[model samples]
Structures are given as C-alpha cells and as structure tokens.
Target: MKNTKKLYYLIGILVLVLLVWMVNDTFTQPGVDDLEMEFQEVAVYRNENNTGPIKRIYAVVVSDTLWHEMEQYGKLMPHTKYGNTQVYFFEDIANAPEKINAQSPYFDASLNPFCIGKYEKKAMGEEHFSKYPFR
Candidate 1:
C-alpha cells in the first residue's frame, strides 16, 4: 500500500511539471509568421552603447557573411566567438554580397573582407523578436 501511494505521488508531480512546462512554452515560442524573414533582418548583438541605438554582436567573422556585392539585409549565417554558427539569416543591408557555399575543404579560396557599410548594427530588432532586441 505504501509503494502504491508513492507511485501516485510521483505521477502527480510529473503531471504538475508537465503542465508548468506547457504553459511556459506557450508563452515563450514565437508564432511562425513572426519569424518570417521577408519583413525582417535578424541579428545577434554583442554589446551596447550609453547614448545610441547600437549594440555590438558576435558577428559572423566569415568574409562571405559580409561583402559589398549583395543587397541590403542579405542572408548569411550568424557566428559566435566560441566557434558556433547559427542558421543563415538576412543581415540589415541590401548591397552586401551573398555568401557562397563551401565547395570543398581542400579547394577553398579566400573571399573579400567585411564591409561595415553593408549592414546596420540593429537589424529587424524588436519588431522581429520582441524578447531579443534584434531590430
């Protein structure tokens, strides 16, 4: 009888935890339409200034992610200083060059350096993800 009571308590706790998790998820996950890139420029900022709309970010250092040949808010992968990279996304510039896909590890060639003029520090900031000041 004691064992059965313990089992019931465990099950009840599990259900409570699940309910909490579901409620949290419902509040956190953004809608699919809000994530669409057609009307947004995604960014991962790194720092902030005291008197500006500026925020530094662990920008993808890859040359192709930043070029002068692509349009404003062109899509490219966001990278971090820790060697992790996010999905390809549109930066906040139109004229930036599109990043070319890797051909082969042994046959690689260097692309051009990043051009600061091609992007804004704040892309589709809060408009895209209100939780993260990405605009």
Candidate 2:
C-alpha cells in the first residue's frame, strides 16, 4: 500500500511540472525574447538572388575600457595592405537591452517584417525567422 501511494505522488509531481512548463511556454514571447541584448549586432547580407542587401540588426555591448584595450591590440585586426576593424565605443545606453524601441505591428505578419514566431540570435542564422508574408 505504501508503494502504491508513493507511485501516485510521483505521477502527480510529474503532471504538475508538465503543467507549469506548458503555462510558461504559452505566455512566453516568441523570437525577440531569445536575443542576448548585451551583445546585439547588425549585419547586412548581400544575397546573390536579391539586388539589395538585407539588413540584420543586432546590439553588441562592451565595456568602455575593454574597447580601448581592443583598440590598441586591434590596430591591424585584419592585417592586410587594406581594410581594418574600427572599434566604435558608445555608452551602454546606446543599446540598452531593457529598453525596446520596437513597435509590434498588429500580428498580421503578412504586413510586417516582424516574424510571428521565434527570433533566434544572429549567431543562430536565419532559418528560424519567417520574415515573410510581408513586403
């Protein structure tokens, strides 16, 4: 009888955990939430099929002091006869993670670039975003 009671308790606990996970998943925002704000970056991809490049915006934040150190060591980051990496230092506020200036258009993704689903970080690539149904 004691074994039966313990089994029931374990099942109940499992069920409760599953319920909690479902609830959290239901309430969580898609995509945009997954971005690591402190290291936001924006890259422009020049697709061969497209005449114009696609802009992928991101935020990259680093300490002011580190920026200087990197600057000295980064002088010849590319190390070639031409081209270089210029570290632009700015206040953290410039890309404050907590402050989102984005405007979520009506969820009719057909009218906007904001995907109606998950928005993974830039490093993850573009497979996750559905920047479509919109012009």
Candidate 3:
C-alpha cells in the first residue's frame, strides 16, 4: 500500500510538471502577427510528393529592410525532416516573384537584382540566411 501511494505521488508530480511546460510553451511561442515589421506574402510553393524529402519556398515583400525580422520570418516557416525550405524577401511587391519552384535558381533571373534577402534550410537541417547582393 505504501509503494502504491508513492507511485501515485510520483505520477502526480510528473503530470504537474508536464502541464506547466505545456502552458509555458503555448504562451511564449511567437506567431506571424507578433512580428514588429510589416510584410506581405507574395508567393509560396511546396512539392506534391510527401513520401520522400519535401520542398517549400516562399516569397515576401517587406516595407523596409530589417535582417533580423527576415530571419525570424524564415524561422517561423514550417519544416519537415529531410526537407528543404527557402524564403525570398523583397522590398516591393511589384518586384516580388508571384511564383517560385524547387529549381536551383528558384526565381526568374530578371528578379534577382530586386531580391533583398534569401533564406534556405537544407534537407539535412542546416540553415542559411543571406542578405542580397547575393554572392
């Protein structure tokens, strides 16, 4: 009887700890609206095949150049195991590409000069974020 009571006490403590963690995580996570910078999504692309590695790409336009906010936006993007995610940031909507694909040069060459930043997450989980004047 004593052992059973001790086990119950341990389980109750574990449950309490889990509840606390869940609440804290739910409240502290950042959402798109939580960002201070103003931006608009122009385009998004995701491959159809789900059995293997997936690819996701996004193109957005921002009111101003804020590298930190761009990085934050990239991090907020959804990712999958053994998948690739990319984000292209532009300063003007007219210059932003309306469509993007999983190709190496994701957007049209004509739009290159207009791109302000780029973010990429490789299949192996490595992340790269670069400001344009891309080299």
For all predicted structures, in order, the TM-scores are: 0.25, 0.25, 0.82
Q: Which residue runs of candidate 3 sit more than 4 Å off their true CA positions? A: 1-21, 133-135
Candidates 2 and 3, the one with greater lDDT: 3
Model 1, 1-135: lDDT tens per residue? 999999999999999999999999999864423322343333343333434333332222222333322223322323223222222233343422234333221111222222232332234431111111222
Best by TM-score: 3
What is the lDDT of every predicted structure here? 0.35, 0.34, 0.89
Number of clashing residue pairs, candidate 2: 8
Higher-TM-score candidate among 2 and 3? 3
The segments of candidate 1 whose C-alpha lies over 4 angstroms from its true place after superposition are 31-135
What is the descending lDDT order? Answer: 3, 1, 2
Each prediction's RMSD to truth: 13.3, 17.0, 2.7
- Candidate 2: residue 3 lDDT (0-100): 100
Superposed on all Cα atoms, model 1 deviates from the true structure by an RMSD in Å of 13.3
- Candidate 3, 16-112: lDDT as tens digits: 9999999999999898788889879899999998899899989999888989988888888999999989889999998888888678677888999
- True-vs-predicted CA distance for residue 114, candidate 2, Å: 19
